[model samples]
Target: MHPKLVEFLAGCRDEAPLQLGVLPFGMICGIASLAAGMPAWLAQLASAIVFSGAAQLVIVQMLAVGSGAAPIGLTAGLLGVRHVLYSVSLADYVRHLPRRWRLLLAYLLTDEAYAIAILRYQAQTAAVHQSVPGTPPGNTAPGATGDAEGSPVRDLRHWYFFGCGLTLWLTWQVSTAIGIVFGATIPADWDIDFAVPLTFIALLTLLIRERANQAAAAVAALGALLLAALPYNLGLVGAIILGLMAGALSTRLARRTRLAREASQ
Candidate 1:
């Protein structure tokens, strides 16, 4: 097999678990969207255009509960606010792309794609950083310690991310259409509600490993519970704000403590 094909296949294998984890959620979103009176094509379009499973789920749920356009749109938009952060992180890798490509990429920037791409990008960056030349004669900062020639190869990683994202995108659209077409035939005994939270727990487990992250997540959970009764799931928005504040404050405090310790030394 060609080297690029091997690399691509490896990436697909590596991301299989995540793909499996997201497919059910995507299918649920399709069912919920169709159940909520959203057009099947609309669900597919949202999945294709927005391409974020969480945001699409929120939009469908809100619509199902009879939310007006403003609140429903706001909820979807807010859930997707994380994309701004994703764009910032992925910018370095995609910066040289054409204007149209950038716009298309921004539209396609889902969480899973961002996660996989960032991991690959970071690895490539570290490799490059370690290969820099012209270190000072006496400097000892692990200067130029990675493979500089490897930076451009990061672009190859984008193909894997794109393949994963596109596959999920197609799955979401098709699953949603099936639900719209046959929702009445499906039994209502399937407890998808339980599954959603379990999915979230798995995703959170993958992302949160540090004490600060744990604290931030705890605070967010507390805030969400406290505001659970708020109308139109505004509680979720509030929880996100509080979580951001908590995380930022925690980081600031950690930085200050480090500064103080350095000063004392």
Candidate 2:
């Protein structure tokens, strides 16, 4: 096998465990999509096209409730705002790739894929930085360009990202197909919709390692609750915007504090 293929397979292996969590969410999304009176084909198509569990769930819920197109579009768009951050974080790692490759990877990018890819990128970056004699610890900058040149690991990072994304894409499509086919058989009392929020909660738990993230999340939750009565579910959009602002502010404050401490020292 080519070295890239080997690295890709390794990436797939690394991502396999996370797919267990993703599978049920994809299935639940399909179930909800169909339950909302959407055709089975469209449900599966949305999985293939949108490829976003949270956004898909929002689309289904809005459709089920007979929401207007503007609200549904706004809700889904708001739910997907996080992907912009993911793309920004991933840009440095993938910037060397061709435009077509970058576009395809962008399409394949998801919460699970981004999480795994970032960890791999950071690990490889740290390894490279440590192997060099002059590099200090904790100095692995996001846009470190030297990591990619003549570095097999850097070359493989894209393949690894592709492998993780492909595995997730396949898992989502297959699980969604099964759900679409068997949706009618599911018990109405089961309330499989709970899986959507649970999946997000699990993702959030993994992501909120920093104090700024926690603060932003708390503020966002409060904002959402306070604005819950807004018409056409616009509160969802408001909460998302408020969350971004809060997170950005918290991060800025933390950075400034760290800089001040460094100056004092």
Best by TM-score: 2
Judged by lDDT against the true structure, how good is candidate 2?
Answer: 0.79
Clash numbers, per candidate: 5, 0
lDDT of 2 by residue, 1-265 (tens): 7767876897799889777677778878888888899888888889999998878887888888888989788778877887898998787777778999999999999988887778767666678676775554233333232344665323546777889999999999998997888867878797765665665676677777788878878888888899999855567668877887999999999999999999999
Q: What TM value does model 2 have?
A: 0.81
**TM-scores of the models, in the order given:** 0.77, 0.81
Error of 1 at 178 (Å): 3.2
lDDT of 2 at 54: 74
lDDT, candidate 1, 140-166, per-residue tens: 122112245654222345455555555
Candidate 2 residue pairs in backbone clash: none
Model 1's TM-score against the true structure: 0.77
Tell me how far the alpha carbon of residue 78 in candidate 1 is from the true structure, in angstroms, after superposition.
1.7
**Distance from true location, Cα of 147 in model 2, Å:** 13
